[model samples]
Target chain A: MAETAVAVHAPGAGEIARKRPYIPVFVILAVVTGIELAITQPGLPEIEHSLRIIVLVILSTIKASLVIAYYMHLRYEPRWLALIPLAGLALVAVLVTALTATVAHP
Target chain B: MAHPDSVDEGGEEHHGSPWPVVIAVGMGIGYVGIVSASIPILVVGAAVFAAGAGGWVHVDMERPSRAFYGLAAAIESRFPRVSARKLALWLFLVTEIMFFSAIIGASWTLRLRTTTPGAAFQAPWARPGEILNVLLTGANTFILICSSVTMVEALAAIERGDQRKVRYFLLATLLLGITFLSIQAFEYQKLYFGDGLTFTQVPAHASEVNKLYGPTFYAQTGVHGSHVTAGVLALAYVTRKAFKGGFTKDNHEAVELVGLYWHFVDVVWIFLFTIVYLI
Candidate 1:
């Protein structure tokens, strides 16, 4: 009699056909980077310094999120795994707040 | 075909390896050497670290990489089943997140303090493109983003058991990583020697800039450049292993793990380009 074996199944051709949109993500990343470069051009119309900073930060954050989600496969992982990075971000928040507070009041 | 190396219901047996402990000991000694500023001790520590790393790689290269799920079958059912190695890698990445945050945060603080009005060191910060070559670095940034794409595609290819595509994609990623580093090295040389952007001094043309500008810029970007170098080395290893047929459709966790690190580095550059270059 053959013994029953438990194994992780590799994805089949059908599953492979349903690949994640890595190319689309790459295109988005490249486009956003281009936008970032365009807005920060030396000869461009002068945006407010603070406003330019805000726009750049938002754009970069979007790019970073896309890479993390699709390229790093975080979006496909179990939900709990995200909590690990979220915990790290929480510490970063505290650190940033403290640093800003110190600079403000010093 | 079912995976030949799958764990049985009783749980897989794990062999202990001493290389990791050796690596840790070597790093600890290296840290002590740095703290004490002793060249001889540092050299010794580095030698030991290299030996440990070589041993680990040699050992690992001999066999196809295996995924180890640490918990027993019954307990594993109670929790989401993640490979033990992958869990450890995620935990390591979290520490990396904190590490980079501290470095960038300190640089920002220095920038804020020195550039503020009525502060002792009241020189203004350099506007965008005043000193550094934004166009060149922007192109380098694109190269890094391309590498990230190839990295993911490599993992995707291996998951489908397409060995040829895996080799090609991994080679592309490794080349792209090398290109990114080469561009960075060229930029660093040009900035430091041609443009006078040393750690202690700014370019003569930028006399009104804060003295801290050079230090902060180098501190933030230098550490990031070092990380890219490390990532390139890791990419080379994985590329070679892929060519050697060390990984399979089911045993390509190393590819995925390295891709995670590579993408993380690209993510860091996304923000770094904004913070250090654009802003």
Candidate 2:
């Protein structure tokens, strides 16, 4: 089906078609979600307390980067374009730092 | 179909459209109404907003959605270039990141401070799966993830100029989005009424939970849910456009932009599910 679509929708001269592994990515996401649920299940705490959080955060970040880079096509667009989101994240870093300080003092 | 930038005879730039300005005016009126606490003013603003939105949709449905090759598109006339509209959307998303950060960050800080020893918040925090329906929301998260997949596939289809696949994938994405919202509505109904987790009410059986829990939960998830609703509406619009032969290989920028927003919403949920539901 993908081959058919790509052939029929053939891009004009300079337009590059994205050939991402859409289904595989979906499978990976589903698997990761399953793992997250499994780790948190009432009886099964395979991961430790503090490390559990780091694991979940890492998994979630991986999923988000997959969506942003592949699905959002940021990887394919001009590199400078990524600076926009990075700038947002930079401010967010400040926000998190200040927020961390508040949490500490509170 | 040639590249959008290629030369063609008499390619006079599109003049302009009035719908955007009208919508802005409506939003301005709505803002004033909100500030003044006037129901009539709010209703009037909403009416104007609806009328403007309908007018715009009607106008757009009449023709294939095209790149606005007008004065505003000139912003892209530089080097290492990106389309002006795409750049604008990216910048818009940057603000959205901070917006969600503020919401989630405040909730996190509140949770931390309240949980600390001898603070104003007296009630113990709800256990991981005590009151909230984690399984249902996990399923909802999966639905959102699937919707993100279909959305990107729809863009891929259009990029290849496969109109049929484009239409079907779009319709699938639209339905998936609707399914996600429907599940969320169901979850909300169960929590608010059946489980007694209301704006101002909490169940007697779960009285140990902090009062702030209900409100902060609603505020954070509610905001993100509203975004999903908006994304669903956009999907519906794009699906209709796909069916009407409104996009082609040469001019499918709308699909990409809409997909960007949809994927961003999914990205937001990725963190939200971890923060709100898991941890």
Candidate 3:
């Protein structure tokens, strides 16, 4: 059925119709999520709670990047477009850091 | 059919859809229903919303409408490089980031302050898998991750002008999204009624587990679940559009944008599952 749809709407001139090389990215995401889950187990009794929190945050950032770059098509878009979301992340960093510090001491 | 951008295409057929207006009205009604807190009104609003959404998809599936608005021209205009739609999406995402951060930050602050020993007033944070169903939600996390894969593939299929693959992948994503929501509903029932974790009320026989559990549980998962619901609705709309053949190789910005939002939602859930369930 999908083949029929593709056949019917043949690619227009100058339009890029290449297959996205995405399977490897999915594999990486799965591996990262698995690692994230494994690190949370109680078996790592020696690790401090704060370090665990840091690890989880870092893992989440990596996963978010994968989705933004590939699924969001940021890599295919113009380079300047990247700055828009980066601004959001910068704001988030300032907010989280400030809030975390204040809460920690207060 | 020749490209819509052809030089002599000024008189080409216009397939302008009316569903956008219908959607706006439905949303207006739904907001009114929410404010009124009337069950009947809410149901009516939801019906209107669903019908508008269904009609929109129905129109989208028919054919790809051509446009002379070249990407270069789009970028060169007032806002230029990024289209208005793309800009709006970015702004919306920024707000979403803040929204999730607020929830995650509040939960973290609560956990940190509560777990402090002999602090003025402190309640111990629940350890991993203590008062919640962590493994079940973990599995749900994986389910969401799989949906993201299908979603990305659907976008790819559209890009390749492979409508058949697009439809199949979209249908798969929709099914996965529905399954995720169903599991969430089941989880909510078990937690709220069976295990005594209500939004405001805790069970009478509750321990310290019942004290602060309500806030954190709802804050973390509630926000995430709402996002999942939104994604599910979007998935349904896009799937219906796919069935009607709404997208083509070069004119499917809507599908791509929706896919971006869905993937972002999946990423948010991944982190939520880690913080709320695993940690």
TM-scores for every predicted model = 0.93, 0.90, 0.80
User: Model 2 chain A — which ten-residue stretch has the worst lDDT?
Assistant: A1-10
Chain A TM-score, each candidate: 0.86, 0.81, 0.69
lDDT of 2: 0.81
Residues B163-209, candidate 1, lDDT per residue (tens digit)? 99889999999999999989988998998999898888999999788
Task: Give Cα-based local distance difference scores for all models.
Answer: 0.83, 0.81, 0.74
lDDT of 2 at B173: 87
Native contact fraction per model: 0.62, 0.66, 0.30
- Could you report the DockQ of all the candidates, in the order they appear? 0.53, 0.42, 0.29
Q: Write model 2 residue lDDT over B68-184, tens digit each, in one string.
A: 423333444463445556778999999999999999999888887887788775566676677788888899899999888888888888877789999999898889889988988
Q: Indicate the worst ten consecutive residues by lDDT in candidate 3 chain B.
A: B65-74
Output the number of the lDDT-best candidate. Answer: 1
Pick by DockQ: which candidate is best? Answer: 1
Model 3, runs deviating above 4 Å: A1-19, A43-46, A101-106, B1-83, B118-120, B200-206
Candidate 3's residue-wise lDDT over B1-279, tens digit each? 333532234443343557778888888888888898877887887888888888866555554533332343434544334444566787788889888988888887777666678665575556666667776777787888889989988877887778899999999999999999899999988878887777665555455543566778788888888988988888887788777777777567677778878988987887787778766
